[model samples]
Target chain A: MDPYALKKLNQCRRERRAALLVTDLGDGRDRVVVEGDPVSGLLGEAVEKAFRSDKSATVEVDGRTFFLNVHLPPPRLVMIGAVHISQALAPMARMAGFDVHIIDPRTAFASPERFSGVRLDAEWPEEALARSPLDAYCALAALTHDPKIDDPALMAALEAGCFYVGALGSRKTHAKRVERLTAAGVPSSAIERVHAPIGLAIGAASPPEIAVAVLAEIIEALRSRGLEARKGEAA
Target chain B: MPEEVQSEPLDPLMTAEDWMKAGKDVAIATVVETWGSAPRPVGSHLVIDGEGHFEGSVSGGCVEGAVVAEATDVLSDGKPRMLEFGVADETAWEVGLSCGGRIKVYVERLG
Candidate 1:
């Protein structure tokens, strides 16, 4: 019921991260975790109380402990080809919880009608990616087999340090890609990070099957990124 | 409009952090060691709060039930437990960890 606690709770809620608002009640005898509406939730007698800043605050009702926090994560995923595989993969990625974007210069392919529920950017890769802004949490995949389109976009993805940079290609295509990347001055190790011939070996032969494989590989990379974060914490 | 629920699934590491911060007593079961063809890789985490609430996975639902029981014990007793599941063991197939690979899980009641 203190003025400071109420102000702090509102501030933290605006930030979308959760924190505890501890306060001293009138009796000054014991501390209780308050739940429900902040204004009406506190008991008149209890002196000390605490609750999470998020609307759903963590409060110990009776003997049970409550865990609550407002959830907000970074927005990340940009697909550099409006191909069929991308169509399948985009929805799957969205379901897995990513802010998905599909980019291609071809208006026919990158139209809203083609991707009804997805964000479609009808622009060339270089321009589109500049607006999307890839970061470590982001994952970039080039589903277009055309070298002119996918190659340059992949270059941008690598430069941005995207956690996962994948491209769909055959063994021969990847070989040519290696040569082109080397000639472009991209380090061999950086090129190695590209999941060329993208996706896990699910023997994927169709667009849908390939989409599953590609997403599986993306998940794998995401998991590895998580592992690195844990290791950093322990260290 | 129900503001589009942000779709990012719980990052396994963030979930682990949440477990520790709650002071609820928690255990982390990790696939520390793995052989070929494992469904989940080494470092895959299955975090369990003392109350049996959990996030993440160590294997495809195969060993989760058994691990949850073991984790429950670990949290109550505040000790560590090591578990192994693989095709070589009789119960491995029953638990789904026997999908042609072996994995060693270390369940530590983290501070």
Candidate 2:
């Protein structure tokens, strides 16, 4: 690998982007290919497959072997509420290997002691998300039950195409949210994507159980997102 | 954050850059292919400095010594080579991987 390639790869890792290192075994020449960079031909198809599968492979392209090294950023869980469910969800999501972040403007709920070892931001979603910004690889769950806090984050998550967008509420409360989001001009298609009532319907009555349900749903969202995600991005 | 994402403090590629900046001739060994339960996945890195200091693993500490020795040659010659390891070593031609797996590691001098 070139020194510049290594630096670029590390930069991709830090900035939460995907990158592919393509090495031409025949000539010993290498270059870094970042997400969405176009390469036409059989090599481009192979590159797309490598990125989708998140796998590295040695391919015999054009009778000369090439090594494709795929680097995918870790999927992150950005919960837009520091409520009891988030307290439980934070650590559970971390244990399940999702980069977890919690945002709540309510400083009392976003206390360090309450959510130790978690990235807790006592700022509104608009301010905090501006710094970290959600992406397609993120799962956003709004659980504050307060529209003042959760609405902006939900709108941002919907626009960002977060893989999982869940909101905690009853059918009635969610209906009101839908109306508000529609009035705010969020696309009806995107607004419909939010998983109202959050979590899997596993009869999760308690906070921790709800956390488990939400994490399971997040995992499902990530794993089941196949070619459709790329198509969505391309569209 | 990369530490948590990497799950390890040392990333071989980053270390290779650091070693190069400190004026060391560096060789990088990458697992380009693996079959049947290879300990490390393909694309895993084991970067070796000219003095034989290494900061990653292409296998479960199985063939690294051999790779480092070969990397020493690669560092001196500035040539890249692919090394294949199987289950056992018979002729000093192939090393053992104890886990009954096979892997192809590509070693190259990085500039």
Candidate 3:
């Protein structure tokens, strides 16, 4: 427990930076690799791989085994409606290791009783998003099916580069929504990022089932995006 | 295997740091690899103090006892050990991983 390493680790945690602590089993030497730091060393490739996957691993470097301990900021989920689907989605998302927040200008639906252990922002999506900016680790879901509510949030999520942006609606509804977004000056490529029909094709007929499908789609997006980003880096 | 217990979102590194700050010897076991029906995913952690108290789960309940035992040694020797348990391993049945899955855990003393 070197004081220097401990200090750096605490700093990284405070800064919400992803990092890896590479520990050489042979000599008990430890080195910290904060995200965006150079990965050129004995543990370079393995560290890079671990960073991309956000998974820790034991790697053999030049015949010496080392453990890469990964530290990542918690994933966040921002829901743009306090509808029934959100009631189901919030708890499930929290259970899956996400910091869940629900934003709805409609205070009646966004009351504490509806979302009992979740953070609620009874403000408009734009105001809530401005207060808590979305990051690359965030997933945004628009479930109200009200363009006035969902469209602004989707636009904000796109601008913020959220890892996942999904909206609940039928294909026709999304088509109309896309047209409105395009008319509203959202780029076609950005509009393409929305996962309309929101969830996977799970034939979800109930709110809980729909919530499951949506969460699964969000996780898929997160993992697939990580893989694609890693591939792009390799290329 | 023990029934899977739902864990709240608590940061393992922070927990380990708090334990260390409180002057307790601690070891952390991480699931580095898994194959088939592994209860926990890679990067899952179980922090163990010298007195056998622990937080988090590296393998639901299948091989936690063995991991905790090895973590005790890690705390004493300040050394790290990589352990493997699965249906294919000799201690799999003894450790109750009978549901069939392989998991590699790396246990080490954490400051």
Candidate 4:
């Protein structure tokens, strides 16, 4: 093991940052250990912190000091539509560490089989979003491709102060969306925050590819939000 | 990966300079800013010592040479300096930093 990995591990242990031990299998594969076998390698509270994903924790190992972010970033994905993109996106977002949730009045589209392992709400947009609640850390995306569904969700997300709000469509479609949202009592500034034509310009065409692009944009937004928060704290 | 055992704990929010000023000799390199998809966050700090020891990270193993070089200079001069690395820098992509993220590190010596 390189000293760097050891040093990182020590710091993470001290700070209670969740760390996985990477074991090379010599076959383009690696094994991960959360707390070692019998968890004996973890000294004191480091083991406990790893399990809990604590924020701001400290651990001592091998005469080194480790500081860790015990708090795991729990990002929420609020999807307004239960379309193909949503289906493709839900699983991928979960893999990327998002708590996926879907809202749509159409129960047929928002079903257990369609959105398995996701929080599905078969209710009107306003009702569903109010029940689930929203926070500054949440990422709200409208993909219904229908103004009726997407607009209401956008209103709910904006009112709840979501960190990232995006809608899928062309530039022309987005302009119309902006107009409708503005007329619906949503402030233009608040509506401006929505990332229309949502996602990086990867020129994606397929649903899966679009999901990839959109999720990438979401992560970037999340990172930027974190930087801003840090700056605010410093200020 | 082999885990290291810790002896002394330090504050995560404090940079290496802050730690050194408190009486512990420390060398720190910090990522002041970043652009694009950087693996590590800006304001990320890496602290080193006279024994060739260190903590934290600036890049995902990329641009480490430059950071080490700057850290060494800080240790010798007993002063602080800033460093930049990214896809924009000709030498950075060679070090495997291809994410197009730009990082500025402030290396400071504290004692």
Candidate 5:
């Protein structure tokens, strides 16, 4: 691999972007393909697959074998509340291979003892997000139920194109949320994506069960990522 | 992908660039392919300097010595090499992967 390619690949990784280091196994020539970088032909299709699946593999294209080394930013779960649900979510998401961060301005709830090894932020969502920022690879769950805490976060997640954005609320609560979001000019289409009454309808009544539902929903959003785009193309 | 804090010190590719920038002749060995129970996954990297000093792993400590030795040769010749290691041939290599898995490691000099 070329040194330049290595540097570029590493840069993408550090910045939490997807990149592929495609090396021609026959000639040792290599290049870095960042996400959304146009690649054509059979190799382009293979690279697209690699980006979606986050798998590295050797592909035979035009009688030449190329090793496509996929480097994807690890998926992250950011919770808007440090309540019982988030306490359950923090550890559960970690076990589910997500980097979990819980943000709550309530210092009592954000205590380290409750969070243990999880990243706990005793700050409001806008302030915390301004420092760290959200990206496409992140999943944001507004578990606070209070719009004061959850609305800014929901808007930010929608704006950032978070793979999953779910808010904890009943249908009645979500109706009001929709009105508020529309009043705030968060386009009706963007507001539509928030999975209100968050999580899979698994009849989850307990905090841990709710965590499982939310996690499953997040995983579904992650795995079924491109299917919606394909649907758009079909339309 | 569990977000293990990717501390730069733990990454072999970052180390390769640091080593190269420090004027040390370096070679990088990457696991190109692996079959059945291979300890390291494909795209795992090991960077070796000319002195046989190495960082990272191509196997579960079972095949590093051989890969490091070959990395020295690649560094000297400025050529790339593909090495296959497995329990398939104990006599063929100086050492074999005792884990009963096969792996192909691609070794090349880092520019």
Candidate 6:
């Protein structure tokens, strides 16, 4: 590897940016393409495909084989509640390769002993979100039934274009929430983005089962949106 | 940026880079493609140093021995090699890939 490529790779790693390292097997020459860079050829198409799939691949372009090594930033999960469900969700999310963070204003619930080996932010949702803005690669879950905490976090997630925004509540609760959000000047379209009655209909009645359903739904949302966006770009 | 998030350890690439800095010859084997029933997904990596120590997995222990052997060659010669093993290829049983899947791994010496 050239010094310049290594430097760029280290920089991308430091900045948590997604990149693809292209190695031309014919000549052993390497090139690095960071996310959002203009890629304008067959190699560009390959890189774009790899980026969309989030998988490295061996692609043959014009009879020359090139290996696209994808380096993606870790997916992030921000849970707006340090409740029992979060206890199950945090470890599962971490195992699924997400950088998980649990936030709550309640010091007792978000205590260090409760979430050993997990990141906990014992601050209000709005304040926590202000410090670490959500991005498209993030999945936000408002697990606390309290409107004071969950609503602000949901709004912040929507504003940040989080890939998944789910709120744990009943349909009636969500209806009441819609009214509150609408009265608070939130647009209907934005309010609709929240996946109320959170998690898949897996008949999950326990915390661990509910955690599985929620993570499954989050993965579904992330992959479907990514695939759709890539299809639109390819079209 | 909170201190906790910043204090999180970097990923495996950084570990490989540190190994190189520490004067250990390192080679990385990446799963570039896979067929049916592959244990590890595409983009999975196994980083091996000159002493046969490895981090990460390419086949969930079904093929690490062979990959490490090939990586040793790559480290010695600095030559990049693309290797393919599968049940359909008859070498799969010998390599312990008997779970019926094909995988193409690209092994390269890293600086």
Cα deviation of A29 in candidate 3 (Å)?
1.9
Flag the better candidate by lDDT, 2 or 4: 2
Best by TM-score: 2
Interface C-alpha root-mean-square deviation, candidates in order? 14.8, 4.5, 9.1, 15.8, 4.9, 3.2
The residue-by-residue lDDT of candidate 4 on A1-235, one tens digit each, is: 2234435544554343345433221211212234433455554346444534323333456765333323233678988888899999988998897878888788789777887667788787888766567776689999988888888888888887787999989999999998898888898889888998898899989999999999999999876764665576689
Per-residue alpha-carbon lDDT of candidate 3 for residues B67-93, written as tens digits (9 for 90 to 100): 889998899988788899988887756
| Number of colliding residue pairs in each model | 3, 0, 0, 23, 0, 0
Q: Report the C-alpha lDDT of model 1 over A29-85, residue by residue, as the tens digit.
A: 112223333443333112112221112232444454332222223435778889898
Tens digit per residue, CA lDDT, model 3, A1-235:
3435756876786666788887776776787889888877767888877888887877898899887878877788999999999999988998788888889999898888887778888899988877678877789999988999999999989998889999999999999999999999999999999998999999999999999999999989877976788677889
Error of 4 at B89 (Å): 39
TM-score of each model, in listed order = 0.50, 0.92, 0.77, 0.49, 0.90, 0.83
The window of 10 residues in a row where model 2 chain A has the poorest summed lDDT is A224-233
Task: Write model 4 residue lDDT over B1-111, tens digit each, in one string.
Answer: 111121233533244444444555566665655668877874366777665566677888787766776777777877667677777777754664777777766666543
Name the lDDT value of residue A83 in candidate 2: 92
* Candidate 1: residue A20 lDDT (0-100): 40
Q: Across the candidates, what are chain A's individual TM-scores?
A: 0.68, 0.95, 0.88, 0.68, 0.96, 0.89
Scanning candidate 6 chain A in windows of ten residues, the lowest lDDT window is A1-10
Residue B32, model 3: lDDT of: 76
Whichever of 1 and 3 has more DockQ, that candidate is 3
* Model 1 RMSD, rounded to 1 decimal: 15.1
lDDT of 6 by residue, A44-65 (tens): 8889878887878889998999
> In candidate 2, what are the lDDT values of residues A19-66, reduced to their tens digit?
999999877889899989998899999999899888899999879999
Global lDDT of each candidate: 0.68, 0.89, 0.84, 0.68, 0.89, 0.85
Each candidate: chain B TM-score: 0.83, 0.87, 0.87, 0.71, 0.88, 0.86
Docking class of 5: acceptable
lDDT of 1 by residue, B39-105 (tens): 8765467888878888999988888888999998877776667788888887854775646878777
Fnat of every candidate, listed in order: 0.00, 0.60, 0.33, 0.00, 0.50, 0.43
lDDT of 4 at B12: 37
